[model samples]
Target: MKSFEKELPENYDALKKKANYTSSWRDRLDAVTTLSAYQHEKVIDLLNNRMKNDTVFKVQTAAYKALVAFGENVEKPTPARFDVIKGPNKIFLRVKKSLPKDHTVEEFADKLKRMRLDVYDAFEGDKGDQFMTWLEERWAKL
Candidate 1:
């Protein structure tokens, strides 16, 4: 299967075309998976076409996922909710308000600290998957 490297023009073109017009769903899947690594402007349209026109549901789904990975607005992105278990000795910071996009993990922890509650472990709500993902990503570096 061709890759998505821009240095290899053939790779980009192959993926852009195969992903949209390939006869084999397997080939289409291969192209869709590689689309995320390429940064061509037209690839978005190709993926969009795959998402909407592909005969195979799997291929269509793969295109949709690729679009999302590319940061394309396939749909509205929802903010994640931070959920903490209420505590007697352990205190969870539960904010009922909307948080700014620039809110940091340090700020989150510090808020709980100021409330004089010891954090055991923080839990995230279903809505907070993106927020938790950011935290987990930072934690991996440490």
Candidate 2:
């Protein structure tokens, strides 16, 4: 997989075109992120619109990731709280409400999977516990 760090450019038009494709979610997100770095209002609008309507999970996830990645450039504040956590090789987000303590780790993992967050070692006891604990803390703050 191509990393977003190397593929994005400054052109907003090209980035918009990339966002319309089905196969290049990561690439498109990279491009958008790069464009967002310039803090252009138009670029942010285009990316937000696409992200809200995107059908594919990967694309939506990428969109959300890009939103967080370029958050500093956004002019308007979003109602949703976005939190990002980086693991060994992937980045995950706490986009909405965190899991409850009553819920099993498997259940929480399932929820994350449903949201298409790249969760790792979800079945391992310690890791799962840590993830749940993380959610619990986040939930408490909410």
Candidate 3:
């Protein structure tokens, strides 16, 4: 029978770094997706870690799928109750309060990027190409 083991990618260290829970959820998701192609034991370990512990539901789901693809027995994780950015409305309201009455949405977006990079990054990752439009709509509602 042929061995199905695969070699780790050259950028494995970088992928590991991105797999850390502290990294943005999107980064972790990207790492999981990239690492899933390999059949190495180390790769399986990394994907299992993400499956069991990543706070983002999407990341967890991706990790679970990858593990299943590798023929690992695993249950689908329940969606995490933790919000990517806690109290996002409150955070944005604070930003809105700090700005001048006449501030444009662009200025608000800039301030959001500067003041709360976590929120900015989370929204950017979650919204993808719709980020700007979502921000604009959110800004108007605020």
Compared with the true structure, all predictions reach lDDT values of 0.54, 0.48, 0.82
Compared to the true structure, candidate 2 yields what TM-score?
0.35
Number of backbone collisions per candidate: 4, 0, 0
Q: In candidate 2, what are the lDDT values of residues 1-142, reduced to their tens digit?
A: 2233333355656767876644444555566555545435565566676556443343444555566665534333332232222342232335234665566545655665565443322212113336567655543443
Best by lDDT: 3
From the highest TM-score down, the ranking of the candidates is 3, 1, 2
> lDDT (0-100) at residue 128 of candidate 1?
36
Model 2: lDDT equals: 0.48
TM-score each candidate: 0.43, 0.35, 0.68
**Tens digit of lDDT per residue, candidate 1, span 27-112?**
77788887756646777777788777554556667778777766678853222233333332223224212234466656654554
Error of 3 at 62 (Å): 3.3
RMSD of each: 16.0, 12.2, 3.6
Candidate 2: segments with Cα more than 4 A from true spot: 1-10, 68-142
Cα deviation at 110, candidate 1, in Å, is: 67
Candidates 1 and 2, the one with greater TM-score: 1
